[model samples]
Target: MAFLGFESKVFMAPMAGITDAPWRTILAACGAGNLISEMAAINAIQRKNPKSWQIANVKDEPYPVVVQLVGNNPELFADAAKLVTDLGAYSIDINMGCPVKKIVNNHAGSALMCDLPLAAQIIEATIKATPLKVSVKFRKGWDNEHINAVEFAKMCENSGASYITVHGRTRAQGYAGVADWNIIGEVKSAVKIPVVGNGDIDSPQKAEQMLQQYEVDGVMLGRAMLGNPWLLHRTHHYLQTGEILSEPNASQIRQMLLKHLHLLVNYYGEHSGMAISRKHIGWYVKSMYDAKRFREQYTKLNTLSAAQDLINEYFLRIEA
Candidate 1:
């Protein structure tokens, strides 16, 4: 099945606050399937918020960028779709997968899963507003007791969703426990629309396994790609050659981390970017030599220079 008119089959999931422009560019460069921008708030966009507009813009991105929007109001969601499509997104995705309190309390996000009819309304309205292809990312249901991915996938297809992404956990699960791939397979079986399976795809082997076992149209990698952009390239290579790609050495990992920090600094400025990089710093240093000590020191670093120094020192110790 074609995605946003492209034949590519892998996607970097629209991870809120994580899949930024730099991340999209790096993943696209490494042969990631069509890139998905992080989710933008429909309410923020409808209010003409500057931050929301910037977050949705993707005109200069290298790969086909599919913009994801989150909101409860059908009309507002439709308007946001038009706005992002105007900004040159190849497609627009509705976020019915987020389980955050702010979004769910507003009847947006995975809360829509609790009401499939309204979820269909949102999809219908968004599809009518823009010529760009539309997709929806949703959880199994509000909880295990309310599992309805099959029913929800059908509703999305009937309402004109061009594709569907099923995150196997429910709203109540919230990244806890193992993702039940069986639910994702069930959703794929229930829908004629292209189904992309997401959740727990942390390694290239797991990616290939998901593709082989579920027969999904695509695999979307989320949290696993953090501080590991090479996963995109490695997964793509393994898919094509049937051989596992070697993992990056500690030095290589450190370099990637530094590159990411530089890009983030360029995109968000030093102060804001450094704060954001802290989360990634923690991820990159894990399991490496002196990682715990480096993490402790890095957490206290407020300047880019200090962070760079700490990284250099940590790697130096590893080499020594």
Candidate 2:
């Protein structure tokens, strides 16, 4: 991320269905340098998947956004890149790291790891088709049977990708065990393009550790920032000033959740908006006292007003 000359080091990884415009816009305000949209299926985009179409909209996005696309076929993947570039993405990211059954079974995602030549071809086609900058996200390899991130990073660089992001886990590892920062360090050493290190970065200290230990250009946070966009700003501050910032208090957390709800309603209409808002609110309250009670009450909220009223009541009690 920083190697892309990003002013901020904290970046939000693309999470399907969860990292939409409303969420990206919110994260952007919290000092996230980049926002990556969830991976859109190449077939879906080529066939004009209405759901994918809605998710790819970058018209009113707050800052430079990179849309990630995934598929096995080089032709379809190339077409999808062209489509998103026409939609005004700041950049395009190819997904070679997804380990899902559908994605892998289709010979895409981590499946591409089995064939480096084909993976290189996909990168070539993507670079040829789009005017936008190209980047790649991938696991170390299909498994320990073939760990070749350094060579793969070279392939991406040869194909004209601006950068590479390594997750530091083999496809076999899934999200299971620890991410080998040493592997990320290896990939960084092997490539001229910037390497963005992403794995289980849960806090600013861990982010600093990634920079110091791995020598990566930047860090990407996926699940760790679930209900805490403030992590981005805190991470940026820690990197620059070497100081830790206080976590948001209950009242402030409530306010941020409410602001998110408002954005969701503005973006996705009220009925569906309130329903989706509950999930995020649930994540926010999970670490608080009486979390079970909060989730139980919050789930029953069918309207925005009902949910906001309950949230206000909960925060008032804490503030008092």
Candidate 3:
């Protein structure tokens, strides 16, 4: 069953530098949920920044793309909503859950949680700007001392948001401490719009736990998904079949790493692709034999062919 035009209820939470076009294409291969682009600043979109536009681009993607925008200006958000709608986004997600210092210093991202009236105005402006569904992603609250997930969720719904996603941590938490899933439930109980829970959902079991325990409509997989592209497919399969699929073996991991590298090369050209592939290469080799030593050597590589040769030899030695 489709949730918001996606094949599954699970969602890929947007992460800067990681959920680019090449990564999404790889993560969508075996199974998929709603795929979100990295958050693009509304200011950049309005200024017609090419890098920002490329981050939000989904023209050739085969699946529905949810473009997440971050900013506090209502007028700019309205203008951005219009631009993404024209660019063919399936929906626009307002980013009120980001806890980055630069974003918060600008009164955007999770910082909007502290200013309810302004947040409402931004949501309302974007809703009126386009025909596409508009959702808002936010945290539990500005902090523990000012818990307001329920209030925040209600504000979004009242302002005409299509749905809401709660990243069960407060802005003050900044990815530390356990995510308070109960706050997500509180938001769910307070709103008529569908609620999706985010944060600390690293495995399929955790994703299902959010759905069944908190009664959230869906779950968003975050940072834990960095090197593990198959996580979306694995979680989706577990939800539908109640089966625990095995993690990819070394050989299979190699195949995916190469596949991702190839996509980055084709999409961004080999020069940039090889440089970008290093981080993923580190992730893909996690827990493999001699991984620490291999990573040291791989980092010195500057070309795709060099990386490929190293990977082939390293994985073969592991298999042997």
Candidate 4:
């Protein structure tokens, strides 16, 4: 069963400050399956925050977009679900596995994992509130000793969640250590619903291995996709045909970086856009010839043209 009618099995896990509209649109163009948006707070949506509304702005998006919501309040989540539905969200994903301190401090995010009753309420309320498909993203558990992914998977299924994505780390791990695909397999086994595995599937080979090893329904790529947009397409293609695709060469990288810069600038304006593109520029040129100094010079430039000139010259010098 395709979650939200997504035919492709490869998905993009939303990264805050990274999976904005421009980025999501780019990923859709790159041939990712259903795109999960950066998680926004249900409280902010209920309060009518412009930032929250901006995050839910998928009304005009050409690709299917799942607007993820995070909160401890089931009522607010119900309201936010309807609002996002009005904003054209293709589905909803509850953020039950965010391990950030501030979030858990407020009894939201992964904190909900420690309180399965409330988590169930949030999920069931969200599913009942929207005609759109509902999904949950969670971890192995709050900690190692409290490992309860299998139990949580059963809870999600019983609460009527249409899909689930299991990131193979606990709240305590917070992205460190190797992700346990074994837990993902366990979750897949514990529930009959579609289970998508996340975490540590960095390369095409690893992504394929996750599918083959964990027996998951799909794979979601997160940090690995930073600056490596082609990964989604390459991984998807490799899974479909078993043929590895060529990595983008120097010229191709240059072209992609330049296009990404323009997209950022157009969406966020020059000053902020140039500032944001610095990290992306670094990611794109990671480990390339003289990239350290190149990144330093790029950061110092305030104007888009200066940044553009730097990117072009640096890439050209590397090619020469």
**Which structure among the candidates has the greatest lDDT?**
3
Q: State each model's CA lDDT, in order.
A: 0.85, 0.86, 0.90, 0.89
- Stretches of candidate 2 off by over 4 Å are none
lDDT by residue for model 3 over 253-278, one digit each (tens)?
88998899999888889888888888
Q: TM-score per candidate, in order?
A: 0.95, 0.95, 0.97, 0.97
- lDDT at 255 for candidate 2? 82
List, residue by residue over 55-116, the lDDT tens digit for candidate 1: 89998875678899999999888888888888889889999999999999999999999988
Instruction: Give the alpha carbon lDDT tens digit for every residue of 232-262 in model 4.
Output: 8888888888999899899989988888998
Candidate 3 residue 170 Cα shift, in angstroms, is 1.1
Better of 2 and 3 by TM-score: 3
What's the lDDT for residue 58 in model 2?
84
Provide backbone clash counts, one per model. 1, 0, 0, 0
Off by over 4 Å in 3: none
Query: Counting only residues 3 or more apart in sequence or on different chains, how many pairs clash (N, Cα, C under 3 Å) in candidate 3?
Result: 0
lDDT of 4 at 297: 92
Those runs of model 1 whose alpha carbons end farther than 4 Å from true positions after fitting are: 1-4
Best of the two (1, 4) by TM-score:
4
Better of 1 and 2 by lDDT: 2
